[model samples]
Target: MVLPRSSSLKAFLVGAGLCGALLAQSAAQAAESSVWQDVQKAGVLRCGAAVAAPYVMRDAKTGDYSGYFVDLCRDFGEKVLKVKVSFVDTNWDNLVAGLQSNKWDLAMALNQTPERALAVAFTVPATDYQVSLLVNKDNPKLAEVKDDISALDKPDLTFAVMSGTAQDKAISSVIHSGKIMRLPGMDEARLAVMSKRADVLVDASDTNHLFALANPGWTREILPKPALAKQGVSFGVRRDISPADLEVLNIYLRQKRDTGDIQQLVDKASIEANAAK
Candidate 1:
């Protein structure tokens, strides 16, 4: 009660600082809670889509989007969040960066990895993923290898992989001797193998399976005996997203997985992708 003027002034300043800090914390909380609400207000949920077969595919002539993840994005936007859905064309390398820059609300078909987790949040997996090799059936180099991918790790062999993808990293790590031709997209990598520019096309197992099915006579899928980069493929969101906002996505994914809708979408997309081929 008898404190000096300086003491009182110091106390007042301390109180003001605490109040300011509290106010800033409240504002951050409000911003986090409004994440989904912001999308609803915008009236459109923009999904960052990159073409990867059986997961995401874009039609060339019509410019239409398909695949299970695309369906999931549409379902979440229109049915769950009550907003229109739009696809923002991106490639694997840009998926995380686009999410970080707010270029899109979600990045489709992103494999959950420790490196990626540091930059973004992820919902429950929509499906599993593993890397595989798709080689021309007649490639004499692979004839003696069977499932041993290491056998193909020779300087004479060329491996084609989409740059910045999990498969690219996986193959690059193991195939020191082989030439890795990093392409811009899955289609380009596939083209490299089909056109004989590369001896092996490295991609997701599901994608390679579909590709081999579509070209049974020309392509053969090899699931490396030890596997490569096996992980859950999930939708990538901003790291700042609130737990509640992320739970909404997890609930939707759980429902889809339980009802077997996810598998159905996968089958449908595979059929369509093959038909187009």
Candidate 2:
């Protein structure tokens, strides 16, 4: 027993509408894939980052940039994407600004939280680290690891951090001592501890460890109290970037993580630098 002509017509219309919707979705995806192609045509992949030692720091004498962030991104460019990456030597305050203006194609070091996700799209988690406490070696006052950044609340304590960053915000609101000392950049923040200009520095755990090795007389501690927060490290791309390219990069990043290649790079870097003295 078959349906009447009117009923059959309605069913055909419904099936046709579903096919149209599927076709439209496929076309949209095709358009989105154009992003990576555009980058390839441009010839240079501009990456922006600050001079945060062990992250993306510069050499003092040669004025050349170096650090884990630099190493990681450069390899991602040459090895993964097979592109030529050029550095823009950006600052934290200007990272979002630069990306918005299209001055740079990507933000090299980014913390991918929901707030940041709104501003720009992020790649898969390249790494993760926690906020840690750094102090002079002789400063027994800070021996205990602080789970909360608020430990800086003691009127006698002060924090040194980059001039423009989330650390400054954390120090003002949570630490709340009104004693947050400002350094020009990450390099200076590391020095603030050694020169006795600042009591402590709060930054990413791995970076702080790099500083501890370099300074020798300084101690790096991830507070025992509680993680004030853990941030997923990732690369940032502007909202205007093509979704297709971003998807490809995302897949590329995930593959890199799954292969244990990421850890292998870290392990090799650790051995080569031997900075954790």
Candidate 3:
């Protein structure tokens, strides 16, 4: 039997609403996957960058940016995406937030941490990261410490670390007795050690290695036996990025890694950073 006129009209309206909602959801998904299309349309891929020496660096006078991650960003944008690459300066604390707010398309040189994984997506890592300590060559207090970082956990020794960095978190969790001098950037943290305001400078192993190379007689680096916060350093993108878009980045990284181009970039950046010191 056919339904009454009133019932048929109500059913039609409900079905129409459901269909409209489904269409809207599909459109949203399409828009999310269209990030590549959007970049192509704009003709530029903006990368959010924070200076971290070999990973990311900025020129003092010219404000030009360079580093392994910077090179990767340029290569991906220009070679793979066929777009111009632009760097948007940011700091460690804002890298995730900038990506969330659409301030940049990619956040460069971010360590893939579980805390950050909650808010963003990461592409394949360009490099691995581990923490190390930089200390004065004549610091007798650390003479017996050897490879154990825990020996530096003393009230008299102050550790300088870049605020909101992975190194800061790693050291803070274990060194309760030592005073922590949290500074805003790498330069400030290095200065704290140089001026004797802090006894140890905690930073990336690669960075500390370069620093020791630059200041041969003054500083040295200690790589702990049990590495601290060892993780992959990757590019951060919006969590909603489509698998297709994400794959494009992963493929590019794999190609560079297989071709040994990533290592070359690392060496070049390390030399530049050491010479600039």
Over 121-220, each residue of candidate 2 has an lDDT whose tens digit, in order, gives 8888777856777776577766663555555577777788887675665455577653788877876786776677778887877767666666564475
| Highest-scoring model, lDDT | 3
Clashes of each: 0, 7, 0
Q: Per-residue alpha-carbon lDDT of model 3 for 10-90, expressed as tens digits?
A: 999999999999999998876665678889999999999999999999998999999999999999999888999999988
In terms of lDDT, the poorest run of 10 residues in model 1 is 27-36
lDDT per model, in order?
A: 0.91, 0.71, 0.91
Pick by lDDT: 2 or 3, better one? 3
Instruction: Give lDDT: candidate 3, residue 138.
Output: 90
What is the per-residue lDDT of model 1 for residues 1-277, given as tens digits with 9 covering 90 to 100?
Answer: 7765998989999999999999999998766655789899999999999898889999999999999999999999999889999999998888899999999999999999998999999999999999998888788877787788778899999999999998888888888988999999888888899899999999999889988888889888788878788899999999998888899899999999999999999999999989988
lDDT of 2: 0.71
Q: Give the TM-score of each candidate.
A: 0.90, 0.80, 0.90
After superposition on all CA atoms, how large is the RMSD of candidate 1? Answer: 3.4
Model 1 lDDT, residue 253, Cα: 97
